[model samples]
Target: GGAFKETDRGQWAHVVCALWIPEVRFANTVFLEPIDSIETIPAARWRLSCYVCKQKGVGACIQCHRNNCYAAFHVTCAQQAGLHMRMDTVRDSVTGAETQPVIVQKTAYCDAHTPSISGLTPNANYVEDTISEKTREESRNKMKQARKMLAKKRSSVPVILIPTIPPERVQEIATLVSITKKAQFIQRLIAYWTLKRQYRNGVPLLRRLQSQGQTHTGFGARNGIEGSPDTSELYHQLKYWQSLRQDLERARLLCELVRKREKLKVALLKTHEEVVMMRLNPVEMAMIKLLDVLFQKDSNEIFNEPVNINEVPDYMDIVKHPMDLSTMRTKLYSKMYYSLDDMEA
Candidate 1:
């Protein structure tokens, strides 16, 4: 009833539509049948959902490789079903070589379709029990060797001949002995040098004293100069000479004796001044004063009193006529006072 064209032949009404007597009774008259068959373009390589749980195969899963079969199942579902696996050969057309056999899962069928086995055969794989036994044997041998080495180390030395002193103590003993010997040698050298110095100074002093007809007093009190002869002997000798001068009426020789005594007194006073100056430090002066007071027995006089020029007696006043030993003894103290007065002045 619509526009008729040769291209719209089956596109309009199929030939089977004419089988109906009225053709209006047939469904094809209202809706035309497909003009051409569906084109089979190799099925588009689609991923099959798991046949057991019907979930998308996202993890380790297996697919049925039976003829015209596209059933898939997860690996745990396959193992629980106890299905047997088979191998299929796939050849690479570009390399013209057969690749390794690919495993084909047969888990789509139930236990009725496939036989089930409990465990894998030992001869089928080598890594499980065989490798574990070998590793255990190696570990045992290593432990045994370690234990033997520890035993040998513990019993390395004999029990009877153990050392009395530790090695470190023996070394320390040797060090101490060497140190003591070194110290003794140094001390001996110091003593030898000190004695040699004393001998060098003492010989000359002894010789000088012998020349002066006097005995050496160990070493000199000041600078190793010979000390004066015995005081008592000199006094007696001077008196004898003074008496001879008077008996011979020699006034000049008497004067010379008086001059000699004056010189002795002067020397004594100079020595006293040097000692006082040496103790001038406040600490030394105080200590000397304290000791003098502590050790004093009867006298209350201060030991280191300051000199007074006015208290000092004149030399001429004490020795107005120095003639013999009788006058000399009395005048000796006067000379001491005069020397002190001179120092104060």
Candidate 2:
């Protein structure tokens, strides 16, 4: 039976047929024998289909546009079948090595039916690079600003220089006869005592200041002022003024002490015993040592003994016979004697 072939299907078939010339070419001469027998395929097999699943094309299908391979895929069907979307890597030209793998898009296929993607440029990772660079720049700017602020603060402070005191003058000052400016010497003394005076006085100066009522407006305002001031306010104000006057008198006395220090030192030597009697045991010892230079006596020579006031008969006996009690009085009154001295010098 003579079988007819459909030859006039399209211009492509017509063109191919027109260009055909019977000749001894390698392609034309090859595969003339039927080594593989052709079997009857089903009508469905002849339809346009998805190359991956071998199913007839129904809905949207992804087709590869590579040379010699136009494979079609039903990616949705593959997804429904729980198949993973394929990935591929691009190569760096200089190193001729593979780069990081990127996701393949449904519109394209890779070489050898791997997977491909479209619209993914090499500059995609640059977005993250730019963000990181911006953050780094901002941190650097903050550090620079902080450093500038620190430098400004350092530059703003005024440097104070302390004047050097001479050794000769220091000895003179120790002798309390240094004829330097009294104000300067007193200022330095005040500064020295400010640090050393903690708890030295029987009454704390802070509590005294508080009891006298601070002249500062903040303290007065904090306590509150009535439109018609109370008697308590007047009392506090009077106390404040009195404390100020006392402070002024104290400073004046100290200044006078400094100005006539030589004469005062002589007077202190003459009245050393009386001064010692006025002091407590610890202060008495310190005062004796301090006056030893003026008195021309050794600190070790100073001694303290508690005096029995009742044994001392007369006012003169309290001073002249401070440690000596009358034997007759001691014998008459075994435990007591009459005297004027509360404390004997």
Candidate 3:
């Protein structure tokens, strides 16, 4: 039989007991049941035992928690597990005082099975001082050598002098020859005027001597006169004729000399002309080559085998000189007419 009357004191005592107990038993079963449903029980469970105190329980001590809580062990086991658990009951064998649990993190050791963390040393300050110094010295030496090599490589070409005859000589010769020819021409005119005056004056004297029946001395007697006809006048006339002949010979010699000089001048001018022509010939050839390059229809043909005259529409622009045009015409005429003439011959 159960007492049904409930007092406040009894109910308060029951609540206090429920709070004090750490584990609550539901339906007197060892396994925990679901709190929401009576029919459901916990599907999986973990049996926790304190490894340090050798106690079986759900809540482990802090020291045993360091080790696997599921492994049950005594205080000695916890010390052996490297988790130091302090016990008031146990004492050290050597010191005769209660042993304090030493809590040190279990370190992994290196062996055939485990990894090691002891051999590694700090490498932050490690340096190859000697090798770095050698490399810097080598680089500086290379730079200095390069600068010296560049300085040594600088050089200059030697200057040379070429000698040449000056053009002033040609100009001087041309001026002298021109002035001499002009003076010779003027002397010839003066000589002709002097001979005319002498011939006019001698005519009347010869007539008077013939009328007076006098032998003209000198040239007059030699020409078949009997009287001595004015010897002085006769001598004057003879000397004038001799002077005229000498002047004519002198003029002829001067003309020959002028001709020789003119030929030399022409030779010099021809040389200069030929030099200019030689320089112009290359330019003309280049112009012709450019024209051929531009107007040719066939891509394979570099230059026409025989250049087509009709293809060059602006041929006159290239061959502008009258002499060149005449030369070309004469060449064409000779090719056409002389060939026919030779065939007929």
Top model by TM-score, which number?
3
Candidate 3, which ten residues in sequence have the lowest lDDT sum?
A: 107-116
- lDDT of each candidate versus the true structure: 0.41, 0.41, 0.39
- The alpha-carbon RMSD values of the candidates against the true structure, listed in the order shown, are 65.1, 52.8, 67.0
Cα deviation of 317, candidate 2, in Å:
96
Write the candidate numbers in order of decreasing lDDT: 2, 1, 3
Per-residue error (Å), model 1, residue 213 = 99
lDDT tens digits by residue: candidate 1, 179-293: 5576566556455645654655433234544434332332232243334466445545656775785566445656766886787677778768758855664444343344444
Ranking by TM-score: 3, 1, 2
Off by over 4 Å in 3: 1-229, 283-345
Off by over 4 Å in 2: 1-47, 80-106, 115-345
Residues 1-345, candidate 3: write the lDDT tens digits: 111222223221122112112232232122212112212222221234443333454322222222232333323223333322222233335631232333322222111111112322212232222225554455446445543543343343333332232557545544655555765665564456456545554232335544333333333544444343455565567778867966886687689779867877777787787678658664443443444444455455533343445897775687663233233334434553233233223
Poorest 10 consecutive residues of model 1 by lDDT? 16-25
TM-scores, each model vs. reference: 0.15, 0.14, 0.19
Question: For model 2, what is the C-alpha lDDT against the true structure?
Answer: 0.41
Error of 2 at 115 (Å): 5.2
Clashing pairs in 1: none
